[model samples]
Target: MNKFVDYFKIGPVFTYFIRVFRKPDPNAPTSQNLRMMHGINRISIVMFLFCLIVMIVRACTR
Candidate 1:
């Protein structure tokens, strides 16, 4: 939806993270880069949270 797109439309935090972790096309504009970078960040964040939960459960059991 338009609202969702507008919400995550390349803010300062996204820009910095993309600059460091994602090799976005320099020629491409921010809007195009935003969608791609958002996907990449979502996947990485999910994986990080999943791993953190697993570690915590493991430590508690041991």
Candidate 2:
């Protein structure tokens, strides 16, 4: 969707790494970045789970 593309400009994998160590910036003018930061973090969690499942399946089959 165009909305998704507009908001999440960063690719899923890169966003995952960036989200890992981000602390909230309280001094910022608005909470828009805060919301996006949380979104990236959520995306990272999902990606991590998907990768873990794939790794587990590959290990099982080998």
Candidate 3:
């Protein structure tokens, strides 16, 4: 459990997930923003799904 939490870097990962689920703040710096750029939401969604799948697999294997 500690290893998995460390692997995900929980703080930042949770922040990013929350930002992606909520509307992005317009005043935030462009570089730090989580909103999709160039119509690439699909890519972000896929990556998120992949991460979830990896976590699920690790849990099951353990």
Candidate 4:
């Protein structure tokens, strides 16, 4: 049971997930391409999470 519980623990991936939504560095150099890329990434991340929640809800309802 303990091992099963440990298997679901949040790890380094959680840090990366948080990093994605955090404020960007003020001093970093900016570019049109880089900004567009990050914007797309943020949108995809939100969409992916929305789909994940939908799937989980459907699974639980069944």
Candidate 5:
């Protein structure tokens, strides 16, 4: 007799998104190049998610 099934699991993509949005460590060394790279990555990730949502909505409407 199971009370609840373990159907929900946080995948790697979700974890990556969380990591990307999380605040940077105060003690960690900072580099301009690294910051710019992460900024670009964040922008790309946002664009990809927007496109994915749009595709899904279009599919569902049809």
Candidate 6:
């Protein structure tokens, strides 16, 4: 379906999951890198919570 294709085409979710599971880059040795890492961590947490809320709402509505 077009919706499924579109979902996978914008690969942010997949990339986020990969980043969540992958080890932190040992070569990162700067304050900017640390800040970026924190940002990514926060984004991932928010995305996860949003997904959880959506699923709960859908289930309740059904």
Candidate lDDT (C-alpha), each: 0.76, 0.76, 0.68, 0.86, 0.84, 0.79
lDDT, model 6, position 28: 61
Best by TM-score: 5
- For each candidate, give its TM-score against the true structure: 0.50, 0.51, 0.38, 0.69, 0.73, 0.50
Candidate 2, residue 62: lDDT: 100
lDDT for each residue of candidate 2 in 1-62, tens digit (9 for 90 to 100): 99978797768768657655676566856577768877877787779889999999999999
User: What is the Cα-based lDDT of residue 28 in candidate 4?
Assistant: 88
For model 5, state the Cα shift of residue 37 in Å: 0.8
lDDT of 5 by residue, 1-51 (tens): 243443454486688788887788889998999788878889999999999
lDDT of 3 by residue, 1-62 (tens): 98987896768866655555665467866562333462366477778789999999999999
Judged by lDDT against the true structure, how good is candidate 6? 0.79
- Sorting all predicted structures by TM-score, with the top scorer first, yields 5, 4, 2, 1, 6, 3
Local accuracy of candidate 4 as per-residue lDDT tens digits, 1-62: 99998998888777867776778788989799978887888898899999999999999999
Clashing pairs in 3: none
- lDDT over C-alpha atoms for residue 57 of model 4: 100
Superposition TM-score, candidate 1 onto the true structure:
0.50
Off by over 4 Å in 6: 1-30
Candidate 5: pairs in clash: none
Error of 6 at 61 (Å): 0.9
What is the clash count of model 3? 0
lDDT of 1 by residue, 40-61 (tens): 8778877987999999999999
Task: Compute the lDDT for candidate 3.
Answer: 0.68
Taking every candidate in turn, the Cα RMSD to the unseen true structure, in Å, is 9.8, 6.9, 7.3, 5.1, 5.1, 5.3
